[model samples]
Target: MYGPIADTIRTQRLVLEPLEVHHAEEMAPVLDDPRLHRYIGGEPLTLDELRARYAHLAAGPAPFHQEYWLNWIVRRVRDGQAVGYVQATVTPAAPEFTVASASAGATVTPGPPRLVASVAWVIGMPYQGFGFATEAARALLDRLAAHGLRDVVATVHPDNRASATVASRIGLRPTGETRDGETVWRLPRRAAPT
Candidate 1:
């Protein structure tokens, strides 16, 4: 019932504001380029469709999954232009503690699960190669770590070299594991300051 929520995260050149339905308008143009979807294999969504999608993302995950859906709109601090977004889906990795009944010492109840997060970022075509994605992703991860959700992973298409480089720059290395047709990269437990 308890989990991490998205916060407005700021970096040296960008600010990651928690995603809202209103962000769809600005995000539409940023995501309009077809080249951006070359690897992902999807065309850009219309503004209206983006609005609906944003609405869904803002609502967080369904109750049954016990997940924390944290999404943020990445924008430039200089001009407040929305460039893209970053997101993390957090779920319990393991139980953090256990409580034993006072009268029945043998009865043990597990406390909350130690959360693990899967992170991802998208920087619009125009924003690509500007280091915004890297900076924004670092900020996201740092915030998660501060809240004890340092176990992070990212899935990248094996053919997307740029994204792979960004993942490595953020201290994640591929474990040669594939999930849902994407490569899984994990971060070290003790993340080094980058």
Candidate 2:
């Protein structure tokens, strides 16, 4: 399965610009607050560190791995200043998985070759409460859906109510699965249009 290529996505108030190394300098201050790391557990990166990291990410996924590392800087369309970022780590899914439906006593089988996306979002402390994260994430999911990548997932620290809210806003529900102490949330794919 072919994975997504980095591309720009636009919404009413924000632009999801494909991430480039040069964005590190601008993102440093936006991600500088230590409070932003309370749930994610990492100190803010310096400009140099961020630049190095961005360089690697900009290079795309490593060879031999059928994966995509798509990242974007969330910028206000009017002011054109980056305030946050959203990303999707996409991998080709197994042929099919059987899922048990609670309301129905039967097993359900998903379609084949569906791409699985593990998504994340981060907005600077000052940018919180502005709905930037929610908008960016919603746009990202729309883009993924357009690409025919339907299995969307996010891992959030159980205590991070803010992130949980964002996930819910983007149509994800808690899956009751825990990985690395984070709750797993998933969004079911929409039905195809006739």
Candidate 3:
């Protein structure tokens, strides 16, 4: 129906729009705060750099790549202010069998591939204390779920309590796992409510 899944995700106060290179102009200043990068590492990207990065992100992965890169610009509903962005890199975890093959000796064939995603979100320094990140992350995860992606995870820096709290608020629990030094949080696949 819609052009992309992100186009259909919105919360009470925020709307997720498909990321565009033109968004870099407004987002660059919002993301320019050095403090915001404390946990994520690296300083702010320049306008030019952000534009280039956004352009590349708008272009999907190379052909034959197994990952689906979904990105969106998080905007405030009231004023359409670009607060930050949310992204998920989804890849097939494993194939699930849909039907039994020949019971005698034939190998059972699997059905569609199941998807797993690693998600991330960022809100500007000016908007950090207002719970926008939590709202946006929830919307992202909800869209992921609606898209049939049940295995979702987020990596938060150990020292970034703010991010860890957001992850927790979104039903993700620390998995006791670390990747690239950041703690991994996961929301196990649960049966959907009837």
Number of the top candidate by TM-score? 3
TM-score of each: 0.85, 0.87, 0.88
| lDDT (C-alpha) at residue 42 in model 2 | 88
The per-model lDDT (C-alpha) reads: 0.87, 0.90, 0.89
Write one digit per residue (lDDT tens) for candidate 1, span 1-194.
22344668878899999999999989999999999997767899999999999999988778888788899999999999999999999887877566566764666677755678999999999889999989988898898878877789999999999999999999999997998899999997773479
- The deviation in Å at residue 3 for candidate 2 is 9.2
| Alpha-carbon shift of residue 136 in model 3 (angstroms) | 0.6
lDDT of 3 by residue, 1-194 (tens): 12466574789999888888999999999999999999999999999999999999888787688888889999999998999999999888877765555758667677766778899999999899899999999999888888777899999999999999999999999998999999999997786589
Q: Choose 1 or 2, whichever is better by lDDT.
A: 2
Candidate 2 local distance difference test against the native: 0.90
Q: Candidate 2 regions off by >4 Å?
A: 1-5, 97-111, 189-194
Residue 184 lDDT in model 3? 95
Sort the predicted structures by TM-score, highest score first. Answer: 3, 2, 1
Query: Per-prediction RMSD in angstroms?
Result: 4.9, 5.1, 2.9
Q: Rank the candidates by lDDT, best first.
A: 2, 3, 1
* Backbone clash count for every predicted candidate, in the order shown: 0, 0, 0
Report clash pairs, candidate 2: none
Q: By TM-score, how accurate is candidate 1?
A: 0.85
**Candidate 3: stretches off by over 4 Å:** 1-3, 95-112, 191-194
